[model samples]
Target chain A: MEHLLPLAAALPLVAAALLPAVAWRRPDAAWGWAVAVGAGLLGIVGLLLRRLLQDGPFSYAVGGWAPPWGIELRFDALSAFSLGIALVGVAVLVFSGRYAQAAVPPQRRAWYYSLLLVNLGGLVGFACAADLFNLFVCMELVSVSSYALVAAGGGRIAALAAFKYLVAGAVSSLLVLFAVGILHALTGSLNMADVALRLADVEARGPVLLALGALTAGFMVKAALFPLHLWLPDAHASAPSPVSAVLSALVVKLGVLGLARVLPLFAGLDWLVLAPLHEGLAWLGAIAIVAGALAALLQEDLKLMLAYSTVSNIGYIVLGLGLATPLAMTGGLVHVFYHALIKATLFLAAGAIIHQAGFRTLRDLRGVGRAMPWTGVALSLGVLAIVGLPPTAGFLGKWYLLLGALEAGRPGFAVALLAGALLIFVYYLRILNAFYFRAPLREQILAVREAPLSMLLPVMALALLCLLGGLFGSGPVALAALAAARLAGGG
Target chain B: MRRLLTALALAIVGAVMLAGLAGLPRPGDPAAPVHTHVAAHIVAHGVEDTGSRNLVTAVLLAYRAYDTFGEVVVIFAALAAVMVVLAPAAAPPPGKTAPPPSPAPAVAPSPVVGFVIRLLAPFIAAFAALVLWHGEALPGGGFQAGVILGALLVLLSVVMGRGLEQPLVPAAAARWLQAAGPLAFAAAMLIGLAGAGAVLGLPAEPAWGRHAVLLLLELGIGLGGAAIILGLYLQMRGH
Candidate 1:
């Protein structure tokens, strides 16, 4: 079982080596190799999560050296976040099979598969890393892969978008490196727990606070939070559908996880105060929710709208994080998973539409529901779940977040939360109305049919997970509660 | 107006960050926590524990080897990305699976440059191998050696006045070679499991097994780094 710890990173890497070789002789086998790696990863991540839940949180010291001297990877209830991420990786690889054949050029399939597996390994390692420097390396791994993944769809716009995303990500990464340098100078420890322990009486309040600020700003850009999110919609929209799904579903969340990993260092410490930071995050989140939803309402491109909606959804999670109560933390963590499920469904369904019918804008996709009913149904369920209808997986995160907001005595945030939900409903109605009520604007809509089983299975599975995530919300809620308890208790 | 707004926003951010920076401790305090704790231990004992006279190599290969493994993978990902983006825009139409056409037109090598490369290649190879061998004891290590070798290879290709995908090192072989660093580290991780039960950990006794593992891993990094750097150059130039 301990061996499984390092294998999470090693397996995909070994696959990364083998993938291009497989791609050389049998371009067809590349996808199979990626799926095999993802399946192996799925089992490993699932076992890690189960073991963590059963035995409580555990930490592995890499290379048999204990920490303060070596790196560590820790798994707690919070790692449930990655269990879901790993599942999404598996589903997306499976989904990309038939979808990539049409959307990506034949020559590029192996490269795409290689990038996807490497990206997955990066995410898994990022979630598990407890060493600050290790976290930086892992963050870079995901960011670099995503920058290229964004460009994989192959168009002038995609190249431009990838470059933009690269610039933003590079700044974020540099800031993280700077912060790590400051922390290292202050504590001489790269192991997070070790640093936290050494910094108990940090004398120079200014540098510590400055480092925290740098880190927060860096992660904010990566997370696409509010003003820092300028690169997101374009990067997410222009990217191929499966790539978009991964970007929206998994990539940004790693930024949030990076923040979660670091914030614990200064939780109750005096040199770096956290109260004001949380307060700032709440207002930032409130603005993001309203601003993102309003912007989403005006988008013409279907994928662009979904991308902006991701911005709005990210706000909910951040707001919950800002609320800072145990319940709010639970909501934020749970939303992290539920949103991944819903957004992946929405984007994959949208990808199917684009692949089959060649439409991108809402106006162009009018009456697509009648032509591709299965994709439409999955899209409708995803829209329902995202709009926070009861008994959907999406509802649980919002419910906890709203309750946390109200309980924390921030009724204004609760109002903002509600208003954001209502605003989201209006735009989702626009999508549904176009799907069901609007007349078919083009002859191509009549020729469209259900997506292939490979793509559709993952779409439907995620939609069902959303429905069941809500129906069986108790499991996630309990897990999230436990995670929140672990976080609050540790810091 | 937009420019003014942008300026105003930038000013506000600068102000906030300045406020935060105002609070940091003075740099390099001799009595700081860093000097008191982790740094003291590593400087005092790291060499003894990891058997590498170079503290950086010791830390990189033994104590924090897992991070180095991840670092190598990140490099591989960057190479893969460059390959994907530069994939010949005019690849044979889907379903055709034709052999890749010859690389973009090769630049003719000047006689002086070819003569220089011919003279330098052997020395560079010897020096790179020397660095890889002595990495555990000296400042030179896998990355430096890899760069030296990789530069020589690329230089050779340019001087030969040919595309990179020759029979000597085909595209498939290049990809595998580029990944050699991570593959080596992965092998080390498995070998490491035999000793420490923890991934990438060396045995407490700092002797033969450890040195053997270190040499294997360093050679892997040296070779991997050279392959990837050359591969990246070829991808950009060839495409």
Candidate 2:
């Protein structure tokens, strides 16, 4: 069980390698293998959660090496919580196995699954990495795999989207690497703890600040923070549904987590200078929330609408982090988890709809709810969550975030949060209205069948969890609070 | 074509000017005198810091490993992008099919060019190996070694038809090798971590372990570099 932590990271990676080889021989088996791997990851994450709850934190030295000298695999509450979110997201993505088989050509399916698995492995490795170099390598693993996955959609637009994503991702990676190099130069260490320990005596504020700026800028780009989010809509909209699910759900969270890692490192810096950065970030997040929702409302294409919604939701996470209260941090962390589930479910349901109907525009989806009831219900639940309605995880995250903002005496941010929530309601309700109220545009609605159980099961499971997460929010909230505390340099 | 040549010429001249401003020194003999302050500083300080005999290896492997990593990733990103862009939209045509033959008249390889490539291949390989092995004690290291390997392959591709070379270095294999190199470097860092308590943060070790770790890391770099260059070549050939 203790060893399962490393296995959680290794399993998907090993599976990725094995997938291409075996997939050529047995195409049918590939989906099954991917689902099985997803299930295994869920199980591993569950075990890790149990262990984390029982123990304080877990550390594994890969190949039995010590820290600052060897690669250390650390699993504290923060990592375990993030890993859980990733696992849930992966499980939702596995729902696409059926949709993919039905929609995509057979030959492309194997590479798609391989990229997803590789992305999963990279993220898991990122969550557990205690070394800076390992983090960068894992980040690249995730980035390159994501770019390929985005391009795998097999369209001219998809290729262009991939190119945009590649360029942005490369620039972000270079910035991150530059920061890591500076950190190494300043501290003569590549280990996170070692760097932290060494920075106590370093008076070279200029370079340190530069490194922080670079890291922040790079991560903001990756996280699609407002003005730096140019590449995101195209990449997300043009990507296949499963890839969209994973990208919006888990990949962006990696950037947020990177920010979390860097925040503690710079805690000792002058708050006056840092205050502006946070204020700007908060403003960006608020604007993004409004801008993303407005943009989403204007979109005819369902996928593009969802992509903008992602940008908006990311704003909530960053806004909460910017608020800098314990409660806000908790909200941010919990949003990372809740958003993964909600977004993945919605994306999966959307994929299912697209697979069955071959329609992508919201107007084209009129009366789809009647045609595919289960998918409709799952999608509706996902919408409710995103809209921050009751008895769903989405509401609880916003509730905490808004409360944190108020508690921090930033009524302006509180208003922004409320406005963002209202905008989400407007857009999400539009989706629901289009699905349920509008007349059927296609005559084939009578013959339309439900998505395969493989797809429906994961969506329903996630939707149910979303409800359960809101109702039983205390457990995760407490865990996230603890994790946030740890991240804030608490014991 | 004329405009393009003029633009290229202007770009080269501008680059040279910028390099001059940066006080860039000319590539020279190892034992030759370096008159410039920067060159002298590099020669004097680089050996102690990097423990390499080849000044180029010293700078690449240690002083500027971060830039080297970026260069490697750029090549890798290019390869990945090409594969994604060019992967068949439908099932690939079956059999070991060649691209439709070019209509251009065949020009015989220059006798001098053939002789030069044949002459340089072994010497280049030997020099690359020397650079890699003596990286800690000299200026040349993994990056230079990799460049040399790429240059050799380019020579081969020029002398031989792309079709013949394509079989020897398949695109897929190049992709794998490209991926494997960074993975290998990462693995070595992980291995080094086993002794030091952190990945890539190797301890002041049992002298042997330190050397072993560096060698392994360099090997990963070489493997990744060679594969990436090969992948690029294949892509450029539109294989």
Candidate 3:
């Protein structure tokens, strides 16, 4: 069962290698090969998930060596993130098949598919890595592919944006490596569990504290937390839509995952020490929520609006975790999946609209709903869900988070949560108004047909999942509680 | 004011870090926790079980080869990224076709420099191989060998001119060479299944097979790394 883990990460990579060479002769079939690899990954991940949950968490020691001497791939609540990440990979790749034709040219499609494969492989590896250094390597695979993917379809602005992103990302990655080196110096082991144990025995809490600070600061940059998020808007907005969907829905979450994995190693510290860190995080989350929404509210381009909204939504998740209650952390965990589904649906629907209608601004895209009603429905549902309307996937995460804030005696954060939701509703309303209430600003929109069935299927499927997930929120709620308990309860 | 704020923030952070670091044991203390636990295990059992006289080799190749595998993939990703960046931009369909691929012109090297590099190239090439082969028992390993080989290629370019690097292996061929590291690592990992050991774990019973696989992996990585280093320099210095 443990052997399946390496295969899940490797299968995509092997395909990534074979794809360009294979597609040299067949261009249309390049996507098919990628989709096949994605499907295989989903299957492998499903079996691993079942084994992981049933076995109540285990670690696979790489090279059959014991911990502290070998790298380990852990199976836990955080690692289960691989399953969700893989699911997103399959959905986005399926959407990209027909949709990619518009954005990426035929000459670059093969390279695009290989880059996608490498990206997914990196995500899976990042989620499962139990050794700190292994995590960094996995992240490099992710970062490099994503940087290239941004500049992929070829545009001057896209190249500039990707370079900006690369600078911020590379700097943070180096900071993470620096922190890991500090921890290795203090603990003498690369395995995360071993590091935690050895640190408990060490006399110096200073290096441990410093490591935690560096790791958190580094990841905050990656996560695009309010202040350090300058690169995100351009990178997410300019990249081709399929790449945008993954970057917005999934990539930044790795930063959150890094915090989840590393910060807990220092949880053994006294409340007085840990409180300020969480408190500071909570403050940052609050500011990010308001600031991200305000910025999103002002964006003229539909895609840019959605990009900024990601920043706001991430604020909500970070705020939930910052509250540091089991219930709040559970809310954050539930948000990870809920937001992934909602954001992916929204981006895919938006991409279809842009591809079919040939407009990116809200004013130009006005009344596009009349021509493409299915995509309109998906877009409306996504907007409503993102604003936390009832009977939608997005409501439950905020509900629990709000409850957690009140329970934690931080009624102020609860107020901030309400304000943030209202802010989200305001910006998303602009989109809804543009789609429905306004008349078509351009006559060309009247000639626009529905997006091809290949693109429409994933959008509607995700929209349907949102409704079902909302209706059956109990199962996810329970799972979230379990994940939160496992994380906060300490290993 | 902004600079003042920045400096203030930096000072606070640095002070906190230094305070925390002071609590740590002195650097390189043999009595430290890191030295006692995992490091101790490797020092004690590395040679006998892993069959690598060098403790670093035992650790890198046998005990934690999986991490090394990931590092291989990371370098491979760098090469792939550089290629995609240097790839020709898409031509508009029917409106305009992409320019035809042109053979890049070679830059001529100075006579003295060329003579010197030509004279020294073989010794470097031979030494790189020795490092690659003796990595198990010596300080030099795949990375060092790879660096040596990359230097040799750089020398070749200077001696024989710019075409020496690209013509030695085409961009198309260099990509395959670059990917060889991860592919070889994967092969090594899958072969470990015969012993039912974890990924990249070699079996003790088949001692020769174990050593042979390790040597193969080192050679593969060294070759792949050398190719990629040269590839990156050439592609970045585009025509």
Candidate 4:
């Protein structure tokens, strides 16, 4: 079981490598293989999570070399995020069956599934990576695959958007690699724990601060936080829908998780003050909240609206992290988990509707809810969840964050949170209004049918999880609080 | 003025980074933490522990083998990425299993140039084999040998012209070979588990088990890298 740690990530990757060859004779076999691999991953992660719950936290030294010498994969509170990765990975892969069949070119389907698995494997590997260099490697795996996935559906806009994303992603990746090199040179260790321990003894603050700055900037761009989010909307909007779900739900969250992982490295230094950094993060996060929501409100394209909303929701998570209290961090972490579920549901449902009706804009999609009632209900549920209505997944994160703000004696931040939520509510209401209430701007919308079972099942399943995640929210909140405690405790 | 501001910003960033780097311990100073800590241990035990005479291979294949596995996947992913974006456009029409027709070269290579390439190819192949075979004792390793082999294939493709679009390797075989890096790692992992009790741990009883695993990895990386490089070249050359 302990050896199963590496297998959690490796299984998907090896399966992915085999996918194209396996599907070569029968192209459609790719979907089944991918979904099986995804389910296998989910099972592996489940067992690991169970072990994590039984034991406190565990570490696996790769190739039997003890850490500070060889790479380590730690299944700590932070790594529990692999569960979310696996869960959403399975959902997204299942959703991709019909979605890819329709949207992706027939010749590209196997490669598309292959890229998706690599992306999931990278995300899982990243969450469990206890070595800085391993994190960088896993990140590259995710980043490269993501860029290609955007263009996998191949149109001029997708290609252009992918190129733009590639540039931004490359810059961020370079920054991260530079910082990793600097840290390695500074401390002579690539292991995160070893680096942190050695960093405490180092006298020079200059290099440490530089590495921290680089790491923060790099991860912020990866997270698509605020001003750095310029590449996200176009890339997300232009991508095939299932790819959009994976990107918006899981990929961007790695950036925030990266921040959480690295912030502890600097926590022990006496000369370094993280307060100014936190203050800046808080301010940027607040502004992003308002700005992203406002941008979402302005978008007429349905997927583009969801993409901008992703930017705004990321603001909520970042703001929680910025507040820098255990409660605030818990809020942030919980949101990270719940938001993955909510956003995946939203994107997949939107994909189904668009795939069915062949119209993408709000006006064009008007009354689509009435036509495709089941998918519309799921989308509406997603809308409610995203808007933070009570007893829904989205509400808990924002609620905890608002309380965290007041707990930290920051009423201003609390007000900003409310204002952002209100803005989000307004945009989401527009989606509901267009989707359900308004007369069809296009007459053909009335004739559109519900999405096929393959597409519909995954969307409905995710939407149910979105509701259950809130109803059974205490379990995740408790786990998040535990993670927050560990984070708040200085390394 | 905007350009000036851009330059100014870059200069500022460069200066700060330089200042930070200057604070680093001087390179090759034995007193530096890099030299004294993990590096010291690797230098001491790497050979004995891993059974590779080349300490570089020892570290790469033994102590930090998992990272090597990741790197292999990264290379594989690179190929996967290229294929996903470009393969569809370059693919043969549906229901056709035959290779896509390559547009004829505008000017055929000079027979003398072609002859020279063909003449040099065998030696290049031998050199690649030597690099891979001697990786345990020499500076050259799988990636280096891979680049050599990949370059050889590309050179041959250029000279061979029309018939070479399918290249030396068949399409079906090329797919498997392109995955050789990761597939080899997976094989090594299972072998290690059976023989050594750890996921990538080389066995102690056989004494040759470690060597076999290392050689297998080298071949995988070398062959896999060559295939992927060729695939990228062919795909990007377009239909």
Q: Tell me each candidate's i-RMS in Å.
A: 2.0, 9.2, 2.2, 1.5
Please give the RMSD to the true structure for each candidate, in Å.
2.3, 7.3, 2.6, 1.3
Candidate 3 on B160-203: residue-level lDDT in tens?
A: 54642335666566656777787788788888766647778786
lDDT of 2 by residue, A156-252 (tens): 8988898899899899999899888777666656667767766665665666766777899899999998878889999998888888888988898
Q: Candidate 3 residues A1-491, lDDT tens each?
A: 67988777878876786576677666788889999999999999899889866886777877788777888887776777787678778989999998878788676788788888988988898888888988888888889899989888678888999999999999899889989988888878889888877667666666776788889999998899888899999999999898998998889998888888887677665532677888888889888999999999999999999999999988988897789998888888888878888888888899999999999999999999989999999988888889999899999999999999988999999999899999999999899999888999999999999988889988888888777777888867876788788678765
Evaluated against the true structure, the overall lDDT of model 4 is: 0.90
lDDT of each: 0.85, 0.73, 0.83, 0.90
lDDT of 1 by residue, B171-228 (tens): 7777678778888888788778877577887755546878888888898889889888
lDDT of 3 at A224: 94
User: Of 1 and 2, which scores higher on lDDT?
Assistant: 1
- The candidate that wins on TM-score is 4
Global fold similarity of model 4 (TM-score): 0.98
Compute the DockQ of candidate 2: 0.11
Where's the lowest-lDDT run of ten residues in candidate 3 chain A? A266-275
Q: What is the DockQ of candidate 3?
A: 0.53
- Which pairs clash inside model 4? none
**Residue A348 lDDT (model 1):** 92
TM-score of chain B of each: 0.86, 0.65, 0.88, 0.94
Q: Give the worst 10-residue stretch by lDDT in candidate 4 chain B.
A: B161-170
Give the true-contact fraction for every prediction, in order.
0.73, 0.05, 0.55, 0.65
Better of 1 and 2 by DockQ: 1
List ranges where model 3 is wrong by over 4 Å.
A25-29, A105-107, A270-272, B1-19, B92-107, B111-120, B154-166, B170-172
